[model samples]
Target chain A: MKTLVLVEHGDGKVHDATLATVTAAGKLGSVAALVCGDGEEAAKAAAAAATVAGVDKVLLASGPAYAQMLAENVAALIVPLMDDYDALLCNASSNGKNVAPRVAALLDVMQLSDIISVEGDKTFTRPIYAGNAIATVESSDPKLVITVRGTAFAKAASEGGSAGVENVSGPGDQGLSSFGGCESVKSDRPELTSAKVIVSGGRALKDAETFKEVILPLADKLGAGVGASRAAVDAGYVPNDYQVGQTGKIVAPQVYIAVGISGAIQHLAGMKDSKTIIAINKDEDAPIFQVADIGLVGDLFKIVPELTGKL
Target chain B: MKILVAVKRVIDYNVKPRVKADGTGVDLANVKMSMNPFDEIAVEEAIRLREKGKAAEIVAVSIGPAKAQETLRTALAMGADRAILVETEDEVEPLAVAKILKAIADEEQPGLVLLGKQAISDDSNQTGQMLAALMGRPQGTFANAVEVEGDSVTVKREVDGGLETVKLTLPAVVTTDLRLNEPRYASLPNIMKAKSKPLSAKTPADYGVDTAPRLKTLKVSEPPVRQAGVKVADVDELVAKIKALGIA
Candidate 1:
């Protein structure tokens, strides 16, 4: 079977999730990559994707229409190219979730989303009910569209055999939607998904000011990415992007620190894969303690400061 | 201008579903069901638009079993003018759901179509974009904010990196995100009024859409469980443990 992996990139570099998706695609069969963007930067991204270990070839589709990744045009580009591949794979990122379904609709096939394990060429395992249960599914369609959860697979090597790049023009503009600008949170901290150490808080932190004042110092000391439980995010202690839970971004860091978090099942689903888990909370019976490799029962206000000072 | 809001009846977000012993699917015998949380946000957005005079009417649509009428009634009680239930008993996939909505959109000719970014049950996150592609219309997905003008809609979408703004022509599809708006509760009077609201029911065959399970479930099992570890006495012990683990 031939798998076409969609290579995700930004600022002219391949994303870590794309490398993980490539690893998932490699388990099925021969793997090729499709990198879509505009101008010379897109060509550069395609060249970067060609160096990934599992990829055999890179298909580059560059145009102004592809820049913002409008689903209509992006799906149109992938639909015609689907005839040559048995399966189409992408990272289960925001862009992938937006574009993969449209392609599946155009091809009249069902999409297998957020697959954590590949049982065979056509069978896969995915989390259901907010990650409480895992469902193994098999698709009978002639072609398959799938999105791979990055946390479940290891990243494919970035350097290996040199694969050839082929440039092709994508489908025409749909003229229904246009790019309007993007505003991203400017942060110097490591990204949550790829961070080696993560410091996450919950609603117990009280207010946003206290949340930042208490969490940032410790995170800074450990050189860790900051994350939040859904309760903290809902309480406006942090932005939604910092949410680490079933409804938020799934992460698997080397060390995960849960401070003032109760560890709801939703939150546990996202970070249970971390190598070493530590929890600090005032309550000894907090659900977070159940999963923590090392638990500390104490007031975070005092304990966190002391921990930070000691570090 | 009419606004079509797509609602889905799913297992209540508060309920933790259990897989059957036979490994078929989630047990739904006694579980509570409600309108999907994100779909409630979409309905709220539509009601707000109608109140602002951007929409002349709001129509709530759901594709599920007959019990889905309860979800439509919830939408109606929340201020939708009417409701439509595409009744079906089979497991309808996202592509088929998009096709059914496309048929409804063709007949209703609504100025805007709104839906949740995804349902928590399947979490496919596909129907809205697929419907837009089928109708050859623009799509604004994962929208945290939406502003409808005379001929177009401006949306602020929640993306992985951050917020992205996009503009789409009229008759476009918009999917709601978590932070879009807080949905209001339906008061007692509105609940009484919703009983009188017009709710029409139809089958997938009426729309010439094939609603079938495209994927087969091989097995359902619980994920690996994590065991509780030892507890430390205080910050000193916690730090010692961390240093011993060589993680920090």
Candidate 2:
């Protein structure tokens, strides 16, 4: 089996999500990574991808067109490269979800999205109905297009392989789309998908100020990524980036501590995959307890600070 | 400019789906149904655009069983000028649905196509992008905000890291995200008027698109349950439990 994994990167480095996809691809067959970017940063990303454990080869496509990582331009670049590979895989991040379907359509095939397990070379397991059900789906098409749920797979080593890098051409600046700009929250906290531990809050935090004063200190003490329930985000306590639910980011950290969260099923869909779950809520009967491994029923205001101080 | 919006019928988001005992699929018998939430956002965006005079006509389209007409009526009550239903009982996967939408777009000649980033049921998140590919047009997915002007549209999209903005030329495909706007309620008067508005029924065969499932489902089961651990008395015990998990 031949697998081509899309390399997701930022800040001149390969995101750990790529390592997870690379690991998933290794299960399928010989692994090759494709890094699409522009100029120097693209080279940096390619070099980083070349070192992912078990990545046998890295293909680099650099130009102004790829700088924005627009789906239109990126899909254009990948559709032409599908002639050689049996399967194309990428992390189910925003970029992957944005581009892979278009590639599948242009290739006249169907895509098996967000697969969690490899049932076989042609069959995979995925979540449906906001992750309420798991479906084992098999693709009959000649080529398989899949987006791996990074949280479901363990990441490969970041710096162990010595794959050779190959330069490829990019279809320069397709006038169909253009990158206007991007605004990512500048933070020292780890990215949500790859973080080892996460401290997430819910609407029970009440408002923005209370959320910051209560959740961040606890998160910082543990050096964990910060997440929030959809209620918190919808209530304007945090930006969309912080929301963890079916509609937002899905994280499977080693320890997920949910604060003041009622544990709506939608919120559980995002983090129930975490290995160990801890809940902090004033109400003992909150639905979050159904899935939480450890329950702490009390006021978060008093409990969080005490936990942060004790830690 | 004309706006074309695609909506879908899915289980109400509030319902906890029960997997069938036979493991064929989730049980959908006698469950409450509603329009996919993100598609409601799409229809809302289209109505706001028409209200702003950026669009002259709004057409809602859906591809599903006869029950989908109720979803189309919901769109009509939300201010769509008309709706078209591509009726089919056979499973219409994303690729086939995109083909049918492409045919509809071709016939309607709308300047814009709007779809929910994904349906709550299958959650494939593929139809809009596939339609864009088949139509050879630009696409903006997971859009939080959108602005239209002469010959171009600017969309601010929600991504993994944060928000990113992209500019697409007119006659483009855009998918709605949750934060786009709160969908307005269908007023009692609007519901009455929606019955008078034009609604057309067609089939996938009429558009020469095959509504066949390309992927086979081998099994469907409930997600593995995470058993609840013992509750702790205080922060000290909580920290001890976390530490016992071998997490630093």
TM-score of each: 0.98, 0.98
Model 1 C-alpha lDDT versus the unseen true structure: 0.91
Off by over 4 Å in 1: none
lDDT tens string, model 1, B101-191?
9999999999999999989897778899889888889899999899998899999998888789999999999999988999999999999
* Candidate models: Cα lDDT each: 0.91, 0.92
- Tens-place lDDT digits, model 1, residues A1-311: 99999889977789999999999999999999999999888988998999999899999989998888888788888999988998999888889988998888888889999999999889999998888889999998999999999999999998894899998776668888888999888899999989999999999999999999999999999999999998898788988789897768889999999999998877987899898899999999999999999999989999999999987
Per-model interface RMSD values are: 1.2, 1.0
Q: Choose the strongest candidate by TM-score.
A: 2
RMSD of each: 1.3, 1.1
Model 1, residue B144: what's the lDDT? 85
Error of 1 at A309 (Å): 1.2
lDDT of 2 by residue, A1-311 (tens): 99999998876788877788888899999999999999899999999998888999999999988887888888889888888899999888889999999999999899998989998889999999989999999998999999999888888998899999999875666789888888887999987887889999999898999999999988888889999998898899988898888878989998999999998888998999998899999999999998888999998899999888888
Error of 2 at A174 (Å): 1.7
CA error at residue B99 for candidate 1, angstroms: 1.2
Docking class for model 1 is: medium
Give model 2's docking category.
Answer: high
Error of 1 at A39 (Å): 2.1
